[model samples]
Target: MYLSQVKSNGKQYIYLCVYVGTQEYSTRKEKRVYSFGETKKALIKMKRWKRKFNEFPNELLNLGCGMENLEEWIRTIETGITKTGRIFKTNVKRAVF
Candidate 1:
């Protein structure tokens, strides 16, 4: 997602755009755009959206350390044990892959 500013007849407008999908080079890409009246309101909405979606799950970070198997990750979380014997008080959630 991104923001775009437009000027028309000396008036400024803000737009919030999301990239929805892609297509072949010969076809147009899919996107969604929302208009937010002015700079102040647009900025506030942008901040809220950022706070809502910018969070990364900690379990996802663990994937880099050889926890590529979902079942193993689930067991580790349930038993709260690691190779170093450290207990992780993790609140796991259903995450999309």
Candidate 2:
């Protein structure tokens, strides 16, 4: 199973929980971001990976530290254009509706 959540800091994180090996539960997750999904799935996936490697991979996940598309974000910010930007802009339309 897979699960995801948006964090208070405005980041999206995903976790996977599955029984991939002899283990009955497993879990995988972003290192930092939203962290520790609200469900049991995350634990399940971790167990699976643990069983597969017999140890942790000893690597770091993106953990949602940087924007997934930093360049696109930069372009939008530079152009002062984007759905979110437009919506949040201070304008007459926003003041009325």
Q: Pick the candidate with the highest lDDT.
A: 1
Residue-level lDDT of model 1, residues 18-39, one tens digit each, is 5556756635343435565554
Candidate 1 wrong stretches, greater than 4 Å: 20-30, 44-97
- Please give the CA lDDT of all the candidate structures: 0.43, 0.32
- CA-only RMSD, every prediction: 17.5, 15.8
Candidate 1 TM-score, C-alpha based:
0.30
Collision count for each candidate, in order? 0, 14
**TM-score of every model versus the real structure:** 0.30, 0.22
Model 2 regions more than 4 Å off = 1-31, 34-36, 54-97
- Cα lDDT of model 2 by residue, 1-97, tens digit: 2222333454333332333444335353332323344223333334444345433233323323222233332233234354354521111111110
